[model samples]
Target: MRRPDVALVAWGLLGTVAASLALAVAGQLPFGLVVLDVGIALAIAAPIALRLLGVVIPDVLVTATLLAAAGGVVVAHTALAARLAPRDLPLLHFAAALVIALVFMPGQAWLRAATNRLVLRRSRHQQAALQAFLHTLSPELGTLECCRRALAELVRVRQVPGAAIILRDGEAIAHGDFDLAPLVHVWPRGAAADALPARSFGTIELRALPLALREALVRAHVTLGAGPILSPRRRWGHLFLNTGMLGGFFHEDDVEGFQAFVAQLALLLDGADLLARTVAVERSLAHAEKLAALGELAARIAHEIRNPVTAARSLAQQLSREPGLPWVAEHRLILEELERVERRVGELLRFARRDELRFEPVDLGELARATLDALRPRLDAAGIAAGLEASPGVVARADRDKLRQVLVNLLENARDALATSPSPRRVTVAVRNGEGVATLSVTDNGPGAPAEVLSRLFEPFFSTKQTGTGLGLAIARHAVEAHGGAIVAAPAEGAGLAFRVTLPLAETP
Candidate 1:
């Protein structure tokens, strides 16, 4: 028997002996009747009283104590009765033996089995409920959806007003009436592994917690039962319950259920994260394949159009050179239009063909300044104010000519965007060096493209401008990517568009 059970038996025996002695001293009732009353009361009422006091005593211990008390009572009664009437001793002995054999032994076993079934029935129901909840969590559900469903089920099972799931990165999903912001701030990264118990389920009483967390919980109007969602690799987040109204307590079965739920939730979160990444990679691969096929087709078509376009331009130029030709002005216009077509074909070919890069240490600040200087005449003509912001020694390993062309394209793109803007139309080019990379950006104070347009900005033949051939940005992207760099366009702060280029910094000797 456990220590508590042994103590309880000892105390119970002492109390029974004392009660019998008091009844004998009073001389109001027979000792046999007194013992019988005491034994029956203890057998029937002890379990009920202990349960009312929230003490969980095993039914086997109760049965054993009752049997020991009854045997003592029978022995004491038989000794006293034999002195009074020796003739009836055999009858008394036989009756006592018959009762012990036919009733007490078999009754104890049946009583133990019956009590156990009654006690464990609730626990079995709880386990079944938990299992059904787990089954509802399908693999296809996303992280937020999982959290929402889990919180809903927790509130239902635990009968709490609120619940929350706060991930390690500070993303939170909350359900019910409670405020979770304070809780989130206090347990943003969840409990540390070393701080948590082995089972990872713990109660958080307002008084027992640290002052700051306690105050935060008080402000949020909740006491907490929290479990870490952890795996062998890492802790994903925490699951929290509002247990203040529950007197900051959880049943043993509830704790076990909580631990199981969080363990499975961690695995589900991992699977969801992996699935999202897999989908993104698949999309990226598909887009790359599509772009490659489009580039190949564009190259073939450009090759077929280039020779005929060159011949037409040459013939138009020859016709314009004849001094006596009628409609000379019209002939000049034809030559100009053909030349424009030739330029577009050349841009298409550049965008389609991948050229071998000649990489060298190129000062990005200097390159920006030179590109701006070359475009100064056009900027003056367009009434657009252009300025450059550069940090010293911000250099990158790149093909100088190709990199120069990229800057020229971006600046011209910005200049064109600013053409219709109101007074003080401006373009700013900035260069700065960061960890292992150099960044250059050209920003314009002009109407920026919407998100839908921005997404297709670098695609060949995708343009918003009426007169655009749409190959400039596409070619710029190819050249920048060849040098192990990236280019992106976004709406600049306040107004207009910003195009940023990032390149790997040149290594220093």
Candidate 2:
């Protein structure tokens, strides 16, 4: 558009015309004049018509006219006086014109191609930078605010105008200038039409924008492309971008760069996800340490407190017996309540104590049955039928008392769960020997633990039960761990909660 540039292009074209005219006149006057006149006239006419009559006239028309004029001049000059003709001059001129045209053709093509390659190379560099940034960012920045700022910086560096990122949990933490109503409103149509795939990130064509919105977008010159931010489990969510006239309307380079951006972004997202998991794991370990400390302290305190509780209960009983007191029954109830308090305190002390186990060879099958027998009265009271599937003489290396306590706690929890369900409550305790270990499962026909609770089931003081101190499972976990085994909760395939306890089998002497 600059005057000097325009003048240079015009001078080159005019020089070609002048050379053709001179060749015609010097060799054969009439024929040369006709060819020159026609070409020159058309060359001058085309641009004026283009300005006034618009682009309907093809560029090919001008090129063709010039070629014809040059050819005509050559032929006329060749036919004239042979000696004066410089016989090969006309052919040389024509060949030269053709060679010039061919050279310029390739030059223009090379320039165009080079421009495209430059864009692609720059895009790749930008993408690489993004990947590097994300890899470092995930660990250092975990909050949404950090993610948002990082995202904004990425878009800014890429020279994109507007973009939005949606996390897997349906939270759209966004950055840049974008009205999401268009995207939200259009997503159903896009989804119904399979515009976005179920679990992968993808791109939407700018031309694919809804009619009215697309028109408005075009006016704003906003173009968009999207791809998924994938993690191992699933895609986080669709990343929507409005590249607001920069980066030039979704070219091949832009698409490639966007895809590379997503790939790197996904890596960061995965790191963020892993970092989150790590933080959670660390938190859990801290809580467990605290609980273990508390449990140990409680056990020691319980040992100390039991002696006094026993003395107080004995004194209360003697006082009750001695009464011609008006409220003898009430006094007896108080003594009973004192006894119950002692029992609970005993359980807590047991949970906290680090008692060395008396490991001995024992039949797990018989132990399982005895545990069920002790809880039979409670199961009957709760109207829950108890079933046992035992592999007899399955020997285990464990403290018999402690292992039996584990089973009893499991059964009691099952009975409590069954009490809340409708009629026909059922609980099953299954024992089997597999591979190198003995497995015991206590399953009940009741609603399973809620998903949220499942995450913290072994955590101390975390219970959903109204009267639960949240220590039962915590205690059971400790006992199993003490025996060099594991206790885990899983929803039963049948009707209720299933507690699986595993212990290594005793090696034959």
- Residue by residue across 346-389, what tens digits does model 1's lDDT show? 88778777889999999999999988999999998899988999
Model 2 residue 17 CA deviation (Å) reads: 46
| TM-score for each candidate, following the candidate numbering | 0.70, 0.50
lDDT of 2 by residue, 1-509 (tens): 22322454476558657867787768866766666666666655543443332222223434454567556655654554354556766666676567557645764455444543443223446767776666556454764654586578666767655677655555666666665655544343323333444332223454554566454444332345456665555566667665532133345555666777766666676676788899899998997799889888888877888888899898887787773766887877888888777877877887777788899987888888887888888788878899899987678899999888888888888877877799889988888999799998998879888778787888777778887867778888898998889988988886577889999888888
Error of 2 at 427 (Å): 1.0
Clashes of each: 0, 2
Which residue pairs overlap in candidate 1's backbone? none
Q: Any runs in candidate 1 off by more than 4 Å, and if so which?
A: 1-128, 184-214, 231-235, 250-256, 324-328
Best by lDDT: 1
Cα lDDT of model 2 overall?
A: 0.68
Q: lDDT score, residue 376, model 2?
A: 85
